[model samples]
Target: MKKSMANGIENDWPPIAASRSARNTINPIRRIVDRMKISPNPAKEMISLSIGDPTHYGNMLPPVEALEAILQAVQLPTSHGYPPSFGTLDARKAVAQFWSRSNYQVKPENVILTSGCSHALELCFDCMADPGDNILLPRPGFSLYVTLCQSLGIETRFYDLIPDENWQVNIDHLESLIDDRTRAVLINNPSNPCGAVYTAAHLRKILLVCERNHLPIIADEIYADMVFPNNEFHFLGILSENVPIVSCGGIAKRFICPGWRLGWIVVHDRHNLFKDTIQPGLIDLSSRILGPSSVTQAALSHILSETPESYFDDILHQIQSNADYFYHSLLNTPGLQPIMPQGAMYMLIRINTKDFKDIENDKDFFTKLICEESISCLPASVFGIDNFFRIVLTTPMDKTEEACQRILEFCQRHIKSVT
Candidate 1:
């Protein structure tokens, strides 16, 4: 110990360290990707398929209506003030109406605006369980779930998703993980790493499990309604008969505006299960951060109502086109199998490690691809999977084609010979 005397007082100081929450909050993607010190090939320009942000390539962007709304909002004298902690009444009403259906009506009173989908999830997790309580998450799921749980001192129990079956949750495995301390089950439809959309029947099966177990659901529907041509997106909140649902969604993915940092939690409590407890807790917790930007909240109503369906149609077409190309192109590649994405903006490719001479795993493939071919993709290990990597489908067609060609060549060069 070191002490210093000043003004007739002795002071002792020790090295400062991060809190347990801060130290345990590890983002696997950043930790893994940043550790790879290999530089991209000098001869070739880098094509990054790693990032989840759609705005990275500039080919996709927020619709004209959204932009105009923001422009109109910024000029307003009333837009500069702080909104209610949960959200402005108008903004919350907009969210409710946007998600409302002919069969089910969403109430504005149940909505809680958040900074982003991530924050929405954080609130859901925080409100549902305390430290040492467990939440059942999907295996090969979004890494943020694990990070947030760990940071909050909540236990994470993973249930497997069947990749061959379009990454559907193993319902049996999911049900088996439930115990006395299990607080909630997190479901990500139109999943990120897998891009698998659940059917109505599949969603019903999951709902049955939760209903039987009396467990509430935390639905990650950030990619809601972003399915491909043949597939349909189903909201778990809509499907659940009795199980209460807290759906976390935002305009980030659907509107291509990640930087906007606006999201909301829609509480679907048909039986009033959450009306007395979790709902109020979420609203109370939101008071700490005071919600998102007032300007953005002012724009949210127009952003939700004025954006044409054709805008979303065009976005889905582009993503499906990219998914089609990657699925077909990589099928011919020697040691990789691309899982056809049903929806969302990513495709997971399984690296047949045994077929490659030098590649050991997904991380090896990821490192070598960037170093030799100047192509970057995320190793699925960060998403709690192995021998697979995920790539974004938001790149321009030209870049997608170039990336496919490079990946083909990279795999061809590394594939083992049968002799």
Candidate 2:
């Protein structure tokens, strides 16, 4: 056997290691997205509709006041030091004020700010779960929870989200999966890849299930403010007190500052179950872990406290128009079944690979489309659904039209070639 380091231990793998789950599993979409960096064709211009990045269309500019706050924070002699492990009082209060408008009586004390929603999620997992304790996750959900759980040696079991019926949660299936070892149930409203918003009735069913199981709810409402027609946003915190609920939100999607890397996990248990039981653990975890950027925390006061009412109204209107445009345009395109997205900026469409001779699966379809038409879409296999693709509507209206046209022409060419 090979000698180990000076510490004198022999190991097959390197030290500073993760659990088995972490070592074995890779996020499939992330792997493909990584390899997509370099393109083969010299003349091709790639129109990216795969990632939900809002900067592509140029609708969101950094808030002017936010920049001033960041500048002021950094230049101040006292601001360079580490922020309070739980986040600064000013930032926490601003988060509270922001949530107050939604009628969620969030106290600054209940907020745990971290390095964006990703860290907030990891914090939640650390606080709530132990190895062998699994959490229920949505199939094709955001990979953050799955990744976090794997790293923690906690199991992440998935329940299905029905696609044919407007991507509704299969609550019965969820109930069937939970047991004593199950810690929480995670739901993403205005879902990431699907853009399917949960209704009040859906929330009611989920809340009831959680109450029955004595499990807390992990609600991801990052797209809460980006809602459009036929979909009403429901906050789980507003729904029930029977079970603890941790609601995660950030300025990333709503204000389009993903690079800002600021977000919070708010404890919304009406009965203070989390505060009474889990809050101390969460605070301790956050204290030991590093906090969000001090400069970005400074911007929180401006971004959260002073969001213009019209700014939000215009954003919703733009998203609605874009969703409509993509839905209608895609409906007219053969071999693509566009589910009308009720909220958020994604359109998950089924690719009829059987109709296209060369395509074998979603990956094949997406790869061919990217190589031939220079339009990029995310494969559904990444989202736990095969033979479907997600298209982002963050591009300008004209570019949205052009992208759809390119997809149409590509499909036609593909069909002709197959014949």
Candidate 3:
């Protein structure tokens, strides 16, 4: 294929040529996972801590209520046909009611169901920021935040999360990053990669900052209910009055049902700000995708309204037990040290990159470890960090302990001798 010199029509390359936006976007998690193909580790079994999906390890399962609800939904005859563009009235209403707060309650009109939290994020950005505008995010945060922003041609300005301070946002850096073109501030309470939980006070401060800056909050509370026993999960919807907090969440983490692909965006606008502006955009986005699976959509009401608190507590207990085991094991190890995770199913293991002369960065170290030990973890560089890797603790406690053992041995193998 050849391009004309004058008009310069786009190249019609055969079986090739990704668009500029496609070329610019990269899923670092997929990149890291692709290394397993040729890695010279154990063929029969690999202890993979790289995957964030809770179902991979066979430890987590759908609740009886969810499964029964879905089964009942399938027999309803309505589940067979095409679903509503936004979502079922009952489901959307359930989502709104589920996230309602005392001060600023969400209504069904403000909720738009989508495929997953990823889709919710894409939709959120599609409505809020035009191309070339910047949004603030947490550094050492979820890589998807950057990826989702990049594909939309919107810029992502990352503020720091102080690891020493329980991964709380560096407020000064967050404030400094704001500028005229900044449209939104994204918050991932119970952050990915770094299993940090923000306190109510800290989150209120963020809301205050965004409110003062006239920036609406795109709150990613997907892991909202996955906090540890001592930590409480606070919804930004409850905290914000002036700022329009568009909360994106789902049953993926708390209910351990990522495969269902049912998530939603709830506009928690106290003054009808997002309801007027972004709510239509969210609906339009859902219209294009036709919402999440019909059966899953039907189950939303029961899942949100009927699931017992005991089920949630059990899931948290399992995750906390696994996290505690792994964190203690890493701390006891000579070379590996993990920042104790406060929430979510993952945490970061801080590798002394400087001590290991052979390793150039987090990616290099992870690649080598996967090849040598049959243990896999996502490099922290995927989350915009240099010397750490994410350790998913969704596996059973015994398996997590075993993973820690293999990691310690690998660190011992390559760790530089002390002076």
Leading candidate by lDDT: 1
Q: What is the per-residue lDDT of model 3 for residues 22-64, given as tens digits with 9 covering 90 to 100?
A: 9768776776667446565765368888888999977888788
Q: Pairing residues by index, what is the TM-score of model 1?
A: 0.97
* Candidate ranking (lDDT, best to worst): 1, 3, 2
lDDT scores of the candidates, listed in order: 0.95, 0.81, 0.84
Q: For candidate 1, write residues 153-260 as lDDT tens digits.
A: 999999999999999999999999999999999999989999999999999999999999999999999999999987889988888889999999999999999999
Q: Quote the RMSD, in angstroms, for model 3.
A: 4.1
Clashing pairs in 2: 140-383
Which 10-residue window in model 1 sums to the lowest lDDT?
A: 1-10
- Give the Å shift of residue 273 in candidate 2: 2.1
- Which residue pairs show backbone clashes in model 3? none
Q: Candidate 3: where is the Cα deviation over 4 Å?
A: 1-16, 32-38, 101-104
Better of 2 and 3 by lDDT: 3
lDDT per residue for candidate 2 within 1-419, as digits (tens), equals 35576788775664566767668556667877677654523466677887777876677555665666777777877666789987999999998877774545779999889888888888888788999999999886776677678788888899998988888999899999999899999999988888888888888999998998899988888888577855689878777668788888888888878888888988887776776668888888988766888888877887776667777777677767778888898888878889988887888898887777667888878877887778888887777778889988777777788888888888877763532
